[model samples]
Target: MPHTGHHLRAVFRRPDFRRLLSARLTFQGADGVFQAGLTGTILFNPDRQTSAMAIALGFAVLLLPYSLIGPFAGVLLDRWSRRNVLIIANIVRAAVVPAVAAMIWVGIAAEAFLPLVLIVVGGTRLVSAAVSAALPHVVDEKELVTANSFISTAGGLAYAVGIAAAMGLRPLFGASDHGYAIIALMSVLGYVGTALVIRKFTPNELGPDDVPDSGGVSVARLAWHELRTGAQHLAARKNAAGALLVVVGMRVFFGAALIAVVLLYRNYFTADGFFRTHETGLGQIMFASAAGNLIAAGITPAATRLFGTRQWLGMLLPLAAAAQLGLGILFTMPGLIAASFLVAIASQGARLVAETTLQTECADEYRGRVFSVFDTLFNACLVLGLVAGAAFLPETGKSYAALIVISVGYGLLAAGYLWLSRGSTLPVMPAKPKTEPAQALTQLR
Candidate 1:
């Protein structure tokens, strides 16, 4: 399983990988649709009547719960059948989207939509956990990095395409509640498609490998203990723990930048109030940022090879810091756009590499718990960043103080990253699972 020119091609042609890819693409594609549809109702809609605080509040509420208890809840993924989790989660999403869509058709969207979106986001997060846990099951251990790169990068591209399509599709549907309703419904195809794709997987194929002699610990008890367990696990792997911290710190800065970008485009960058509504403006910038993600996907594997994971990650933190400072001082439309792309590259590059580190460093039995911790911190940091931005951003998103504070924060983060990554390297071999037959598994029988 050493590197080969055709190895990537071989991975794709694999039947199980193909099915999983179908599930991923369809789900991610739908995520684009769901997001695009919501834009008309929330983020970018000119008619929606939003303010800087409102946008930040919306995201904060949406992601906060997952971050708080998400890891503990995510431990269920290891105990439950991953196959059923994907299958049930996707189908349930398909069944539920139309209800939200129907609510959109009424004027109650402001009240009802956020809650509905919360459900949709929950389902999406669950599916994501299942997929990440299941991935190692489908591909060879040696191929984890490249395989993940292809899957993640391609899924991101698919999501961007969905967002781009939503831009046009909403207008065709008239960019109103009714229009959003139609777009909301479009996500159903992805959910249903993914559910069907996952049906091909036998129940235990995705695995915890069935730990025996458990002393019959209740799942509820396991849940209570899992977070502590995950923390202890991380404490032991200093480099792995450091890598997770790097991602968390990066997200704090990322959140503030998001607020700045939204404020800049929505209120400030309307081509002197002549062209580009906030919706279009945000979309244009998102497309550009997404393109940076695609570019990162292509280069990260090679970059990791040359620089090594710790060194590459250490370098990315400072680069993102530099970009934020440039955007803060320059504060021009072009500068804002450039900052968006640079951050996207740095963020995606860091995440992809960090994920590879996690999968390789942590034992398979604890991966779900580990990822849950990862997801919880990942999301919690986003809210923290947004909250920070809201505190500093003016109505127009043009506060120099805000920019300076963010830049200073990024400088601190970069310093911490340097301290952590000083002499470490990504381990070549995966950590061994502690238990025999490792953990839990489920069978239809």
Candidate 2:
């Protein structure tokens, strides 16, 4: 077997894979910048008084549209040219973001603000679906795990870089609405960059391979039928289904933890010693999570090869539970940061496994719908978790009860996943005959 470095090099050697990855990195980085700008405007603005419920509501406003349109978007992905979808989606985002920035600049965020933001976010979700659907087309089947790990982790790091850029530039841009508006505009460059990079692919190069016949059905009705078919396909694949369920469960708990952390920084913690303002503290946590994601990219490929995908995922859930418990009990900045790191590793590792499982198990025609379902459940459940946590949490966001419940939920989820997967065959990589180092490297190339 080749080393992890060899696997990554092999994946990146493909020109199409590089192009797709470049697009992903660019758009996701833009997403980070846009998201940070919003965070500054809404959550961290000194003039604004933020609460747990308000935060929950904000999440709902941003995420629910994706849930609503995700399935329909999935159907379009399967039928339409995915490359064009990527290009058009980014163009739409480039157009909509300026509208959002204008709304922010005018300080009128009630009527059209949420709607415009929703449009931008929904477009991002579509781009994400198209990218995920297109991934298998650019890489070989055996390299899926490595390809996914690299793209996912690198994209995340790119997002972190965007956030860091926004944070650093905020002072120059001014921390006021005007500054945030400029920051929001910065994302347009990334959106445009993504479109340009993705244009390198032929119209149908990244594809559904075999498009579903609509049979004179209207798009609305065809979407409904296709969604059902996609759901059935996922349900039939027990491993993929189980992996997705685990990812959803993890997202729910992670969402609650995230909300709590935000509140802790914004309301409870104060600037003293190394601790800074809410924005700075939150930035630290975000960077910590990004660091963990980078680590997961390095570790997961080998971990899954050694332990099998299901078992590795099972192991990660408990680590997440432990991380949650550590933060809940300690309730300090250092604890929060440390917990963020550990939880990201666990969460990202599980996501890598789940994505690979879906790509491996589902046919190309169904992959788009399947990934869209994955996106919908992932975001919807995160919002659901945030809302539920808000209902129970105090203004201080220091609800030990909420944290404990989330930690326990992780444990139960892990146990359930392991039991359900007990009788199933694990997707373990088979060992290859040992070769000279040069030969192994040559094979990877």
Candidate 3:
């Protein structure tokens, strides 16, 4: 491990990793800005109902298509030039965002918010899945963990900074329509930047070429094969399965908890309360959570080393549940705001790093589809969270009891599952060579 660490450092000393890392930062920086600003943009219209609906729809737009398309995306990724897929995906997203912003700006279709948001969301997810699936092709096996860590850190920070920047820019746009337009423009710029960097990459940077099944393959047959291949790879390894299971379960648990957060926030701050009058307070809460996520990303590499990935993630499950419970308790208590935020940041940040690292450790051939499966699970949980949160929060009249029951229950179940599976055999880490900056950028271009 120490020798690998030395090689990791030595590899980065070469310019390729530096450039690849820089491109990652640029792309994710744009992502952070977009995500942070999106909620604010939706809320700018002052129709709380519409804004809330937009938020709901925005999430749906992104998650549903990602889930549905995710199964096939991996197969396509294996068959296509990862770089081309990535570049095209981002460019498509760049184009879509502007169109949506225009419709909203003209007010001709601003009211038809659901369809518009979905178009943008679905498009972005398709692109994102392609990029994620292709990531292993860009970094070395020894440095894969470090690269994954760096990416997760960049992503979380982008989430925080982007949201913060968006909030700050709120006054300039005045309306979410314009704000989203700018964000879309940023997306365009980011994608262009990414495409330029990706153009530098060569085919050698990627995993071994995938030979399509020789047997006459139908669309259904291909999807089934891809899905089963990913599953079989996972099933072959016990520790990897345990790791994957905990992470997937965490996604389901988080879906419910995040829904509770929206409910609590809307009830306590946005809907009506002493806190309701402060406009950006709700935004600040999101900012705080992202901040926590960023912090976790920073420390995750260290944490994974400190706690065995299996044991630590196993334990974090219960701790995260407890954190959610804390969030549920603190939802209405204005005085304990900082404590609530702390818990949230720690829980989410820790989990994000832990899960991503686990997925990256899986086999190279399976990595794309493995991640796709995880993406499917994550998106599925998100959809379920939206429905459950909407149903539970509004109908339950902000029932803390229900929130506690769901959050803690899932946490315990995940923790127990991990504990029992702790002794299981772990998988050998997969091998993948890092792409040169020139090669990664060029192959895709």
Candidate 4:
């Protein structure tokens, strides 16, 4: 609790951290613009026929493979220059996204759409992994908690700004493939800006041991071996591992809720002028959720301090569960939107605690790989939730059964967390003593 204020200000003062934050904000803001356009065009459009399974497939296409790919590719972050990865990945994305946007504008087949979306989405995930891995390089470990909070919150707000921009422009441009192409094209340029921003950092600022070479097996074997090593490191840290599981649980619950909300807004809500259309209504709900996410970052540290990190996380999980079921009971317009805000806060708050815990508890050497594993779990669970919603939700998106399942699932997560940490009062890990970034970079070269 003490010095938290000073530390928050101190985080903003670091020049390199500011550059890193700029990279993240620019990239994520572009992502928001791209996503908002896509959702408006494909998912929420009243003119287009959409289905639950179709929605599931669309989401799974963007997310699920990255789950498989993150850890395997994380070996790159550890072994290669992460700054280069950031630069190259964003550049590649800048090239690829316009192609994807073109396909959307031309009304490509579903099969074609998925593959292109995969390339762009996969690149985005890599950029995100690189940022998380490189984060400790710019800021002191003492500031890691607040730094992560500020960085993530700023990223979310940037994303919301992007979404708002899409909303504002859609009327002028029309919510069609042309509009999607235009918005996504702009994001491509934003990705290039992100590339230039990361250029401020040196090649080796991010990390892996600076061994000159490796006596190795095949590349796949090497990647598998490295992933296993990361798993072992994560396995050794019980509380960090537990926290990750909790975050994954949150993703699953919200993933299902997301699909449900999309369907609910699309079909069940009266389009007879109360909100004008489902897209407008859903956009507002998402905006509220985004605001809650931004707000959560500010509150998480204090909440964790008042109730220990593990305890605070334990409380948030059930609150999320209650929010889900409460929405089930209310099952009305204002109710759904308001409940979404509450659920968003709990989920985002819980997620921040997990990120801070993993970043702090894991050693620097293994940080990238651990984050990869966490992201993998996160994507997989989210895909699973989306698929589950597809299975349970009707065309109307009103499924009491699905809500019950989501609530029970979150309840199990809450109970599981409290049960695991029942007797032991585990302490949070502070930043480890380390060489300065300049010295680390010197050694790296």
* Predicted structure with the largest TM-score when compared to the true one: 2
Q: What's the CA error at residue 27 for candidate 1, in Å?
A: 0.4
TM-score of each: 0.91, 0.95, 0.81, 0.92
| Cα distance off (Å), candidate 4, residue 414 | 0.8
Give the TM-score comparing model 1 with the true structure, all chains together.
0.91
Tens-place lDDT digits, model 1, residues 127-244: 8767887788888766666777778888888888888888878668987888888988999998998888899989888876653344788876777787688778766766667766
For model 4, how does the per-residue alpha-carbon lDDT over 72-129 read when each residue is reduced to its tens digit?
Answer: 7787777788899999998888888888788778876555777777877788788887
Error of 3 at 186 (Å): 3.7
Ranking by lDDT: 2, 4, 1, 3
- Scored by lDDT, model 2 comes in at 0.83
lDDT of 2 by residue, 176-248 (tens): 8889889998999999999999889999999979885778999999999989988987787766687788889
| Candidate 3 lDDT (Cα, 0 to 1) | 0.56
Off by over 4 Å in 4: 209-212, 271-276, 429-445
Q: How many residue pairs clash per model?
A: 2, 0, 24, 0
Q: Which residue ranges in model 3 land beyond 4 Å of their true spot?
A: 1-11, 35-38, 51-58, 108-116, 123-128, 213-220, 270-279, 332-361, 395-397, 425-445
Query: How well is each residue in 250-323 modelled by candidate 3, as lDDT tens digits?
Result: 55545655555554554444444544423356566655566666566555555555554554455556656666
CA lDDT scores, all candidates in order: 0.74, 0.83, 0.56, 0.76
On the 0 to 100 scale, the lDDT of residue 213 in model 3 is 62
| Model 2 alpha-carbon drift over 4 Å, by segment | 428-445
